[model samples]
Target: MSVKPASSNRPLSPFMIGPYYRAQLTSMLSITHRLTGLALAFGTVFLAAWVTAAAAGPDAFAVFADLANSIVGKLLLVAYTWAMLYHLCNGIRHLFWDTGRGFEMKTAYASGYAVIGASVVLTAAVWAFALLV
Candidate 1:
């Protein structure tokens, strides 16, 4: 005799994301934290290339300098700066979590928003200082 498989009305894992549960602020922030981490890794490579160019020769350094002074390069610099600040702020939040704090729903959401705000403000301050000096 053959046995029939059981059937259920439950949604699969992939379908649960949209229909069963909505994305929360905490979850979104967590995802952003991970992406910024990847961005930081790539940014480190760019920084290394710049340093290597400087050590190579004037011609090599000039190539990097020119790129750095260009519009696209400046935008990339701004993005990297933001990523650094965001990662740092989010990391501090994670530290608090590790200490068993900020676990409440309200506190978690507030901290997530604070991290984003602090990163943006710090990025602007750093860029402004760089431009002024």
Candidate 2:
């Protein structure tokens, strides 16, 4: 008879998933901002659809508009907006580095945190305004 491996016979223990060491904060945030930006770009398809449908005729616009005003649409709008803002700020930071600024380790770290902080602040601000007004 065939026997299972020793490891397979026993129940599995706690498992760690995802990159730990490789996901150093800087690298993690950098990649995430880029990804979010890419997602936001795709989200723009809805924007184009809205504009096109609105221009096409009133009936088409009403349908698209109703969907856009729904809960899921609002959430997507908020997320896409924030993603755009974060990507923009981080991109500016990267551009600065490309221009030979903020290159020193200390400066780079400071700017990285600055981008994170700024993104959070801007994203919250947009939502706050969106909600309040």
Candidate 3:
């Protein structure tokens, strides 16, 4: 005789199941840090292409420059800038954790927020400087 397994009632996707399923700052920061790392990896391909274009000569470099100066490219640059800043700040937070520090819940949460705040402030400051100069 074949028997079916009994199922207990529980959400397979905790995120969608309840209003109280809100993500904690630490978890969100962890996911964001990993995502930003991946984004930087992908952005590196563009960086390599730009360098190759420069080596190829003025015409190729000009094409690369024009594309980078376009609106979509500007948006990608902004995203890459933010990702770099976020990854840098989060990496420092991870370093502190590596030293066996900031394990307290309050400290961890505060550091997570600090990383996010620093990334936004630094990214905006860089863009502002770029635009004004």
Candidate 4:
């Protein structure tokens, strides 16, 4: 006769974050920071393409410019702008963390919110300047 090992219903990993866990603000911000970084990388590629098109000829430049001036393209530009600002603000928060600051629960949450607020405000300011002036 063989003895059967006991089976447990507990979560196998403490880091399992789906239905088993509630997400915290800091964690959400951290995830967003990473996503923004990736978006910035893609945006850089777009920028390079714009520059390449400009160098190629006026016709090529006009193609890019026309696409950029479209409604969908404008929306993408706004999103990219927000991503860039969010990444910048969040990166500053990270720098504070590197200095052994803003690690307290309250401080971390405050900084996360601040980063979000700053990014939104800065993005609006930038778009306003671009479109209005």
Clashing pairs in 1: none
Evaluated with TM-score, which candidate comes out highest?
4
lDDT against the true structure, each candidate: 0.92, 0.81, 0.90, 0.90
lDDT of 4 by residue, 66-131 (tens): 999999999999999999999999999999899998898888888888998999999999989987
lDDT score, residue 101, model 3?
Answer: 91
On TM-score, who's better, 1 or 3?
1
Q: How do all models score by TM-score?
A: 0.85, 0.76, 0.83, 0.86
Residue 114, model 4, lDDT:
93
lDDT winner between candidates 1 and 4:
1
lDDT per residue, candidate 1, 1-133, as tens digits?
7766565555554466666679888888887898999999989999999999999999999999999999999999999999999999999999999999899989999999999899999999999999998
TM-score between candidate 3 and the true structure:
0.83
TM-score pick, better of 1 and 2: 1
Q: In candidate 2, which residue ranges exceed 4 Å CA deviation? A: 1-21
Candidate 4 Cα misplacement greater than 4 A, ranges: 1-15
lDDT of 2 at 34: 67
Where does the lowest 10-residue lDDT sum fall in candidate 4?
5-14
By lDDT, the better pick of 1 and 3 is 1
Q: Poorest 10 consecutive residues of model 3 by lDDT?
A: 9-18
What's model 1's overall lDDT? 0.92
